[model samples]
Target: MIGLIGGMSWESSAEYYRILNQGIRERHGQTASARCLLWSFDFAEIEELQHRGDWVSLEALMIDAARRLEAGGAEVLLICTNTMHKMADAVQSAVGVPLLHIADATAEAVKTANITRVGLLGTAFTMEQDFYKGRLARHHGLDVIIPDAADRSTIHRIIYEELVAGQALPASRDAYRAIIARLVDDGAEAIILGCTEIMLLVRPEDSAVPLFDTTALHANAAISMALAD
Candidate 1:
C-alpha cells in the first residue's frame, strides 16, 4: 500500500489521486485502482504555519501523519507537495515505511533526459531554500536555477492566490511562459515544475525547453513502487 501525505492543497493532491489510480488501471485492468492511503491536511492551517516559519510545528504534524499512515498498513509513503517536503526526512524517520522523495524521483527523470541544468518553479520556500535545491545538487549532481526575484514573487503569488484554489488563469500562464523563456535563455535545458500545482498553470507547450512535471513523475514512481515484486 502507498501512503500519500497530501493536501498541502487538495488541488494538486487531487491530481496525485487521479494519476495513481489511473496508472493502476492502465497497468492492470479497467476496474483496477491503486491500493493507497491518504492523510490530507487542511491547507489553511498548513499554509499558516509555513508562512510563519513554524517548521517545528509543521514537522510534528507531518510526523504524526506519516505514523498514522504507516500504522494503517501503508508499505511505502509519498509526500505529495514539493514545498512540504521540507519535513520529508523527519517524517520518514518517524515511519517504518519508505518515503519516496519527490526530488529524488524528479532528479532521476531530469538525469534520464540527459539534462544537466534545470529551472525550478515552486513556492518561495522551495525555490529559495536549500532543502530541495541542495538535495538536487548534493545528491543528484544537477544544477538547478530559479526565476529572478520579481518573477519568483509572481510565481509564488499565483500558486497561493490562484492555482491552489483551482484557478488556472491565462494571465498566470502567460507570466509562467515568460519566466520559463528567461530560464531557457539562461541555459536551462529543462524546467522542473517543482510545485505540484504548477502543472496546472504551465504545460510543456508553454516552455521552449523540456518541462518535467514532478507531480506526474512522483505519482508514477509511487505506482512502480506499489507494483514492484
Candidate 2:
C-alpha cells in the first residue's frame, strides 16, 4: 500500500490521488485502484508555519503524519508536496515505511530523458534552499538551475497567492513561460516543475524543452512500487 502525506493545499494532493488511481487502473483494469492511505493536513495551518519559518514545529507535524500513515498500513510513503520534502529525513526516520523522496523521483525522470542540465521552478524555499537541489546534485549528479532573484520571487508569490488557492492565472502562465525561456537560453536542457502546484500553471507546450512534472512522476513511481513483486 502507498501512503500519501498530503493536503499541503489539498489542490496538489488531489492530483496525487487522481494520478495514483489512474495509474493503477491503467495497469490493472478499469475496476482497479491504488491501495493507499492519506494523512492530509490543513494547508492554512501549514502555510502559517511555513511562512513563519517554524520548521521545528513543521518537522514535528510531518513526523507525526508519517508515523500515523505507517501505522495505517502504508508500505511506502510519499510526501505529496515538494516543499514539505524539506523534512523528508525526519519523516522517514519517524516511520517504518520507506519515504519516496520527490526530488529523487524527479531526478530519475530527468536522467531517463538523458537531460543533464535542468531548470527548476518551485516555492522560494525549494528553489533557494539546499534540501531539494542538494539531493539532486549529491545523489543523482544532475546540474540543477534556478531562475534569477526577481523571477524567483515572482514564482514564489504566485505559488502562495494563487496556485495554492487553486488559481491558475494567464498572467502567471506568461510569467512562467518567460522565465522558462530564460532558463533554456541559460543552457537548461529540461525543466523540473519542482513544486507540485506548478504543473497547474505550466505545461509542455509552454516550454521549449521537456517539462518534468514531479507530481505525476512521484505518483507513478508509487504505483510501480506498489505493484512490484
Candidate 3:
C-alpha cells in the first residue's frame, strides 16, 4: 500500500490521486486497485509557512503525517507536491516507511532517456532553492537549467495565479512554450516540468525537447512499487 501526502493546492493533488488509481486499474484486472492511505493538509496553512520561512514548523507537520500513514499500514509514502519535498528527508527520517523522492524518480527516467542536461520550471521556492536541483545534480549527476530572474518570476506566477487555480490560459501556454524554446536553444536536451502543476500548461506536444512530467513519472514509480511483489 502507498500513503499519499497531498492537498498542496489540491489541484495537482487531485491529479496524483487520479493517476495513481488509474494506473492501478489499467495494470490489474477490472475492480482491482492497490490499497492506499491518504493524508491531505490545508494548503493555505502550508503556504503560509513557506512565506514565513518556517521550515521547522513545516517539518513537524510532515513528520506527523508520515507517522499517521505508517500506522495505517502504508508500506511507502509519497509527497504529491514538488515544493513541499524540501522537507522530504526530515519526514523520511521520522517515519517508519520509505518515502519515494520525486526528484530521484524523475532522474531515473532522465537517465533512461540518456539526457544529461535538462531545464526545470517549478514554484519559485523549488526553482530558487538548492534542494530540488541540487539533489538532481548531486545524486543523479545531471545538469539542471532554470530560466533567468524575469522568466523564473513569470513561470512561478503562472503556476500559482493560473495553474493552481485550475486555470490554463492560451497566453500562459504560449509564454511557457517561449521559455522552453529558449532553454532548448541554451542546450537543454529535455524539459523537466518540475512543478506538479506545470504539465497542465506545457506538455510534450508543445515542446521541441522531450518533456519529463514529474507528476506522471512519480505516479508511475509509486504504482510500480505498489504492484511489485
Compare the candidates by lDDT and give the number of the best one.
1
Tens digits of per-residue lDDT for model 1, 1-229: 9999999899999999999999999999999999999999999999999999999999999999999999999999999999989989988889888999999999999999999999999999999999999999999999999999999999999999999999999999999999999999999999999999999889779999899999999999999988993
Tell me the tens digit of each residue's lDDT in model 3 across 1-229. 9999988878888888888888988988778776888899998899889889999999999999999999999998999989989999999999877899999999999999999999998988998999999999999999999998999999988987888788999999999999999999999999999999887778788899899999999988999988784
Candidate 2 residue-wise lDDT, 1-229, digit = tens: 8999999979999999999999999999999998889999999999999999999999999999888888888899999999999999988888777999999988998898898999999999999999999999999999999999999999999999999999999999999999999999999999999999999899899999999999999999888888893
Ranking by lDDT: 1, 2, 3
lDDT of each: 0.94, 0.93, 0.91
Worst 10 residues of 1 by lDDT: 88-97
Candidate 2 backbone collisions, by pair? none
Model 1 residue runs over 4 Å out of place are none
Clashing pairs in 1: none
Of candidates 3 and 2, the better by lDDT: 2
* Best of the two (1, 3) by TM-score: 1
For model 1, what is the C-alpha lDDT against the true structure?
A: 0.94
Q: In model 3, how many backbone clashes occur? A: 0
Q: What TM-score does candidate 2 reach?
A: 0.99
**TM, every model:** 0.99, 0.99, 0.97
